[model samples]
Target chain A: MEDQLTLGGRNFSSRLLTGTGKFASHTLIGPMLAASGSQIITVALRRVDPKAPPQDNILSHIPDTVTLLPNTSGARTAREAVRIAHIAREAGCGDFVKIEVITDMQYLLPDNHETLKATEILAKEGCIVLPYVMPDITISHQLYDAGAAAVMPLGSPIGSNLGLEMKPMIQRIIETSRLPVIVDAGTALWSNHQPVCPPLYLRLLFQPLHLLRVQCGYRLSQNPADHE
Target chain B: MNININGEAVETSTPDILSLVRARNLDPSSLVVEHNHTIIQQAAWADTLLQQGDTIELLSFVGGG
Candidate 1:
């Protein structure tokens, strides 16, 4: 497994990047990370109570082998995202940040306009900015120009788990963009062991999540690591 | 004196950020401080004294995505 996915000047053999949310507990994250073999894990920043003791903190659970990618999930605008990035780095979380700006409460879609603004600001400040945007080629190019590390296009709305619904647009972006196209959201599975997302589960599941994401019509990109 | 820390009112007599960190049993190296909307660097924590009616926000990365 010499094949590696490089981001922010670092190489990751395990292309999979898993999330800390939607899990049973912080303890489960370790085994799930082991099962998935993800080199990178994403977490969100929240305001903690001053009186509460930091016993089961997420940082204490994550293994030191994996890199921490703190996402700006609560941000509604670019300015707020930038602020969070600074706070994350200052908190010793390092420079890796996932810029997620969502204003649409109904669909929970990523706002590309504000995302681009935040990317430009944070990337300039030496943060590896990975933005989650709608599957649009033009906006992907803009984000690349804004110094983004990778263009993370959503397969569907956040938490929808309707994997790669925007197949045509995501394929177009993957094919045309010079930067790496990361399929970020819309990956969902059921607790009952039922296959809620059919296309992805059927077509691609044996490999890592970052590799072999669904493009138009269950097609696998020629090179799983390089392409979307 | 009373000060706001992470939105909770705390009555502490800690003279500076170092003392405050010690008082709260917080690892001085593990947390970042935003005192009144400005990020106070770790090096300045000792000199950055706490004051009455001052607002201090301590933020740390947690486990959620």
Candidate 2:
């Protein structure tokens, strides 16, 4: 077994980190979390509808033991990212934040310059920052100095589901990184030949949760775990 | 007076930030406030007095990845 992965002074037995983005139902989150055994899950902060009723959202579905990693997904610049980070922390999501600064709307690639700037600022302000980048080694080194708890490099474009197109670059980053290299996207283990489809792949890949020792979502029409 | 909230200009006679939240039917405990781009703690909502042209941002956590 891969030993426990440590980040932000906390030891996580399940290296697999999951995201709650494309689930068909928010109510399914708890059961999905139970099945995957992910220690850390990501959530996005947003403006509450003042006119609407306060319906229970994703926060209510996730287990209390799982760490809530609020991501700055919509931030397009370092300043905006810094602003969101402050809001997330002040809202009691704690100091753990995922810095995702993406300006290119086409590919949705993470802007390395803006992310680096945000990481420097948030880290100094006592946040356990995890930056999602386009897989660059020099930037990873810089983020480590900025007190980043770990560096999350994309396996492919965000939500592309292309599956590790950047594997070579990601390997270089993992090899050179001073901090833990948690592959955020495109880490799913599936090929077209398998009887298990993408949804099943999404669910079961994380079920071998501890295999990565420091790692590991998207959408699907059906709940993937139904196959088992 | 007109105060900008979440980028929409609105006229309100609310005395303090807490009242604005209450007037909007928001649960103060469930909302996170940013006044003029600076975070205002929930405990300080009563202490945070609003003024004309103040920018108030109300945020809450949602499902994301």
Candidate 3:
């Protein structure tokens, strides 16, 4: 029984997905990818700066073996998100698109309604749509009905490093969803000795729990009190 | 003719998308060209002529979350 994560008719051995952002230098990306063993990584698209000095192409740093998950991070509406998805695919980023429609600048929470709208359109267009959204069971069902490949519920706000603040909602989503429930953001738990663990350690700590849940048929105790 | 590239108006005599990209010293292989809201593949860049007031968006992959 080989464990693999399937998305859009493609199989990936690694369950951990990493982002290519917030790094001090682009040179570290290749090494990071090699060390983390992440099969899929997220990237963003933006208008090329005309005045800036020529820089190395980001794609060159990424290995061909890894899958690129281009996100619609700057989109504020479904229409904008759909446009970005088309652009990303046409740009040779593949069919995998992470719909991230966010208008709330303060909290950076995803707009669930707009995310669902984009997911419905992109999935129909034959894209492997993975929508990032707040943890909500109703929207999770809606995303499934809209042909989403998986649902990515945030553990907390994006980049907050608060760890599973929305644990209860995420657990509910996991319990009910037929699609894969990927906990997307706010994963860096606080540490006493260090501010946060290295990215590799974070992945190592997180992946086993995910595997355990999946291996056990997701049969965690249903009762909220049972968790205590 | 004057055309918009990435929301900035530029005056250029470059005839096609390929020439325009070269004139700006941009790497064609690393770019995704959107001409008037529709994507233009690299193979089609030479044939895609630029016109006055045409909106061209030049985009590329960047590190982001």
Candidate 4:
């Protein structure tokens, strides 16, 4: 929790980021957000029903306390992702865009070339681009050079529940990256396998932090201000 | 028509800066100015001008971030 995660000029106090989707109810999201201690909340842009009937805005349920990260979840190409980013901005999400270039349906791996291209163009257009990419150190460096504020590598394919299979690559990326390394997708929990933590160059997505705190058997104070 | 340039009166023998700039073959990027306290963009600066005491300020691009 003490790790510093800086993106787009704003320094976030917590590394844990939660998604606004998959919650049972909108009411449950609030408590989950509080418990997760996430400063950023990722929202799948494709899920937002902009053309919904007056009484049924799915996005209306999301509380304002969490900063929304509109992700291009369903986009298979850079062009589609860029178009979705424009749509998100028009919907008042502004230039804060998460570039998700998952082309493969089975593995959900990011297309490094398309992701790099999208990142360069989006960043030049003043969009704060956070790209979800593969755990390749070279690709991560290329994305960083392309002006991505953060690079999110998947631990495994989305929803497979496989945790940190690319530990060696993740370790190398964390060591050399100038941008934040956000481990996204997969798994229910981080492995309690290592005591000598790899010197993290700013990790994001708080599930790991929470697990660490719990592992230490330290009870965090309930005061919101103290933690926030 | 009469035009003002930095509080000084001048008459451009044309309607606007665009026509004048075009006629003179001037590059719009070489100059910077402000219209009524708001900075006129480089692309639009050549078309902007003072209309009878309309406030105008001239600015030059400097090398720095």
Q: Chain A TM-scores, one per candidate?
A: 0.83, 0.84, 0.85, 0.77
lDDT of 2 at A140: 93
Q: For model 1 chain B, where is the 10-residue window of minimal lDDT?
A: B23-32
Tell me the interface RMSD of model 3, in angstroms: 4.1
True contacts kept of each: 0.56, 0.76, 0.80, 0.00
Question: Which is the winner by lDDT between candidate 2 and candidate 4?
Answer: 2
lDDT of 4 by residue, A13-82 (tens): 7766656544434454455557656667665543212233222233454467666677877788898788
Stretches off by above 4 angstroms in model 2 are: A49-54, A186-228, B27-29
Model 3 ranges with Cα > 4 A deviation: A192-228
Q: Give candidate 1 regions above 4 Å deviation.
A: A50-55, A189-228, B7-14, B17-31, B38-47
Task: Estimate TM-scores for all models.
Answer: 0.79, 0.84, 0.87, 0.61
Judged by whole-model lDDT over C-alpha atoms, candidate 1 comes out at: 0.74
Total clashing pairs for each candidate: 1, 3, 0, 4
Question: CAPRI verdict on model 4?
Answer: incorrect
Rank the candidate models, highest lDDT first.
Answer: 3, 2, 1, 4
Q: Per-residue lDDT tens digits of candidate 2, residues A30-70?
A: 76667767778888888877677675656778788999898
Number of the predicted model whose DockQ against the real structure is largest = 2
lDDT of 3 by residue, B25-57 (tens): 998767889999999999999999999999999
Question: What tens digits encode model 4's per-residue C-alpha lDDT throughout B19-58?
Answer: 6545544344433344565555656755675365455444
Least well predicted 10-residue stretch by lDDT in candidate 1 chain A? A215-224
Q: What is candidate 3's local distance difference test score?
A: 0.79
User: After superposing candidate 4, which stretches have Cα over 4 Å from the reference?
Assistant: A1-3, A47-58, A190-228, B1-65
The CAPRI quality class of candidate 3 comes to: medium
